[model samples]
Target: MPDPARLFQSLSDPVRLRLLRLLVREELHVQELVAITGLSQPRVSKHLGLLRKQGWVDQRKEGTRSWYRARSGDDAPGGTALLPTVLTLAEELPQTDGDDERLVLALGARQAQAKAFFSAMADRWETIRLRYAQPEFDLGLMGGLAQPEARVLDVGTGGGALLPEFAATGARVLAVDLSLPMLVRARKRCRGQAAGEVDFCCGAAEALPLGDGACDVVQCAMVLHHVARPARVVAELARVLRPDGRLAVTSFCAHHQEWMRSELAHQWLGFERTEMERFFRLAHVTPGRWLQRGPRSPDGSGNGNGPNAADWPEVFLMTGIKDADHGG
Candidate 1:
């Protein structure tokens, strides 16, 4: 193993410094480092090699590419403090924040009673197993992310589908869910993984029992629409993200899916792009993108190349920076 002290020294180079900063938020490969730090591939590789020798980082192979991440344990080359310090410093930069509300109240009651409902619906979970496990929505939400060796947090993780793919990227994954049964299922799904590679915690999204700003990317997919108080969930998601960290939340836009409308058995609001903007404003989170299928045509037919009905009701995939002003 490389010495942590020496590893810290190797990370002192400017390009290495920027690379480490970016990786502290999300794992990136050499090409990504090259793109972000404006360094040549050889220089990036050299720094990474030196850093690896010092035990500051670790790499795992996926297909033809290798992704690097901060290693855990005392042997970690970055030493105990280096990566944390770099992450803290990065958080001082400008950040963003995001929210929604009253249907939330009703959702809370349903969530509280989720055990019974989901238990009865467990069989159905298997039907949607592929859907939940490999949600196409995640492709859009995680589009810009997916770093090698990243540590990702999946909040309100149902059926634990997102966990495996994140793990497949060789990133450490932590999944939290409010429903006990859901957590049980998630744990079962990740059984026998390498230690620290995957973890499941039972907790509500509003009161996560995690260290502040610990995850590089915190994602909540398809869960916000089910929360009784989604604004509070937004605040919590923002709270757990490091200032430079990314939060991508995927939920139903107020209108799109006929199934979701029927599932909720209400005239559930689909987001007007503007209304969605307001939701983010309430939580002090700046919206990054409004990913949608092409605009809908008259008579509700989506414009060609727009997202289909199955991709909906429309998915409100939004990303934001964690506001530093609202300290967790």
Candidate 2:
């Protein structure tokens, strides 16, 4: 066989390799990647362009801007497995920084957009909040905390949709949002509840204000899509979980078809079982079980009723535990 030297050359630099790693987790705009990698916009774009020519990356255009994701092959369903050794190699390498840090690049752009997105829609938040964040989903994953008194942290609390469900579960809830206006709406939803019980805060998902291992369980609803650095967010969620804490995070997995792409713009990445497993690995979170639900709107667009039957089978739900052993 020919030498594999040329194959290795494409991913030689820690920076280029790191960019590919981020692409695997989610598709990302080159401009947005600047924050994650701490590199200039041109530099990130250059690396992405090179990766594309190597057939190791692919680009999807949305409006005027373009986003890049790892291309396994032909956009086929279950393509995540096509480059396993590359992914495995990526997993073992130490995380790079400055011009090669994925977290730095991913979070900066996303938090700003998320904050702005929520702030503008604050008025209509309550309607969206009441819709999709269901307790039956959380209770099903973590039944131990069904009591009248439990504590939960709804990370990426968005407009506080999951907060009330958590509160209804007898868990005194803390809803944190990067957008102050969004928090205001969440506060409005919990106004009738006693003070100090259901509370809200203005914060980004990467750096939650709560103390370490502060709550019994932490939840993130469809909001994972809004996050730039999901692995770090998961790490933070794991950080705040009690040793035996449970985590229920819902994320969008790519549909088995290429046609679903146009609708979920800004939905940079979709997870496969391995992809999800890798995310938990980076977060030090562990997967418990995988579940599937209807094409319900993650943004809470439609009535809380499940997604139209036509959109069924493409959506999925994943529940994981913060393994006490995995905690640092």
Please provide, for model 1 over 75-184, each residue's C-alpha lDDT reduced to its tens digit, 9 standing for 90 to 100.
55535755677656644543201001222333444465544555555545655434323344567544565566777889977777666667766778888877777778
Native-to-model Cα distance after best TM-score fit, residue 231 in candidate 1, in Å: 1.1
Query: What would the per-residue lDDT of candidate 2 be over residues 65-164, giving only the tens digit for each residue?
Result: 6778887555522345536767677776666434345555455655666667677777876654444344556567446443456678877666665556
Question: Which residue runs of candidate 1 sit more than 4 Å off their true CA positions?
Answer: 1-108, 113-115, 129-136, 141-143, 191-196, 256-268, 293-312, 324-326
- What global local distance difference test value does model 2 have? 0.65
Score candidate 1 by lDDT. 0.61
What lDDT does the true structure give each of the candidates? 0.61, 0.65
Clashes of 1: 19
Clashing pairs in 2: 26-269, 27-268, 35-104, 35-105, 36-104, 36-105, 36-106
Model 2, position 32: C-alpha lDDT score: 67
Q: C-alpha displacement of 216 in model 2, angstroms?
A: 1.3
TM-score of each: 0.54, 0.65
